[model samples]
Target: MEDLKREGFTLVNGSLGLDLKHCQLVLRKIAGYHAASVVLHEKNPKCFNNFLDNVYSTDCLDDFGPVIRTIFKNCVDMISKWPGYGTYVDTLRSLEDTIVSHIRKANERDEAMYNVLNHGDLWINNIMFKYNEQKQEVEDVR
Candidate 1:
């Protein structure tokens, strides 16, 4: 792993609401990373086959199901205590049983479609950005 901190990159924690410009910069870099991976895979088809093996398959999701549900429940509980958020809490609680399955389904790769290297667990905390001199523009990402 790269020492992003040493490179003056910083990650925005999940709880903080992300501004549109920061979000855009992060997404643009992610898209570029995905695109670059695709090109690399095309150039050396055999090199990427090892990575194509499903490390996060349905069985793996099953392993994480309880943990996922617990986190979901915690989120629901947190929101449940908040005034005027009852509707959202109810919706989240109702989906607890199926959320893991839904995620597993979405993660199922379609062989017919061209697949690139997927950043499987991407979240706000996993991305680090480096800003310009004024700290107003994101110039690099990791």
Candidate 2:
């Protein structure tokens, strides 16, 4: 992010080194986004529910559940090439469960917080950082 650069965030330009501090800043921003969404939902219920009902339809995933399960199962079967095969399979199973849980929770959360706009994607790549002149490393992240 240009703002981060102006602020004092130094980008390594390559994967040769880890930017721990910058990484933390990004993580914090992500957490803040999630928190903001939660707060927004608490403030507005009807709008949130309407948006969820209209936008994120469970029909999509549900209709495709068999396909997804098959893909996941195939991937799990192939993962035996790696060590701790059983552990990895267990983790994969847990991941599938988590996905289902998240979908259900998201539907409920959306209904409760229909006031704020729902962001389907709020990940690192969606955000940009910029450098600030006043800071040496990373300045402001946008």
Candidate 3:
């Protein structure tokens, strides 16, 4: 792995929300990364065979059900007080039983469309940005 710090690149704090400019830069880079991955996948799908490691890809993280339920409950409690969101709260409660299956299906790689391995969990720390000399503008992202 090339040393990004030595090459003048920097990482942002994942705890804070990125500014619109940085968010745009990160999106452009992610889009480019996905586009390149699609080409690589089409040329050699075997290269992606070992990349099937997602949270919902297996039952290993099934223990997280209570966590998910609590989150949904908090969501419902927070939204139940909204003027016109009572139905939405009920809907969220109703999804507790089948949401995990939906998540599993969504996490699966769809080979029909020549699905490339996705880096969809795009957290702030997962990206690196290089700024200009004065650190005013982002020069590149990785």
Model 2 C-alpha RMSD to native: 5.6
Better of 2 and 3 by TM-score: 3
How would you encode candidate 3's per-residue C-alpha lDDT over 2-76 as one tens digit per residue? Answer: 999998899988778788889888878777877998999778878877785767787754877678777867877
Poorest 10 consecutive residues of model 3 by lDDT? 111-120
In model 1, the runs with Cα more than 4 Å from the true position are 1-17, 79-90, 121-126, 134-136
- Number of clashes recorded per candidate: 0, 28, 0
Query: After superposition, which runs of candidate 3 have C-alpha atoms over 4 Å from their true positions?
Result: 13-15, 75-90
Error of 2 at 49 (Å): 3.2
lDDT of 2 by residue, 1-142 (tens): 2455455444444434337776777767766776787787677645555565532346667766666667777787789567767777877866664554455555654333333444567555554555655655564455
Give all candidates' CA lDDT scores: 0.80, 0.59, 0.78
Taking all chains together, the TM-score of candidate 3 against the true structure is: 0.75
RMSD of 3: 3.1
Tens-place lDDT digits, model 1, residues 34-137: 89987897798789867755635548778888998999889899999999998898788889999888777766767777677878778887888888878568
Better of 1 and 2 by TM-score: 1
Winner by lDDT between candidate 3 and candidate 1: 1
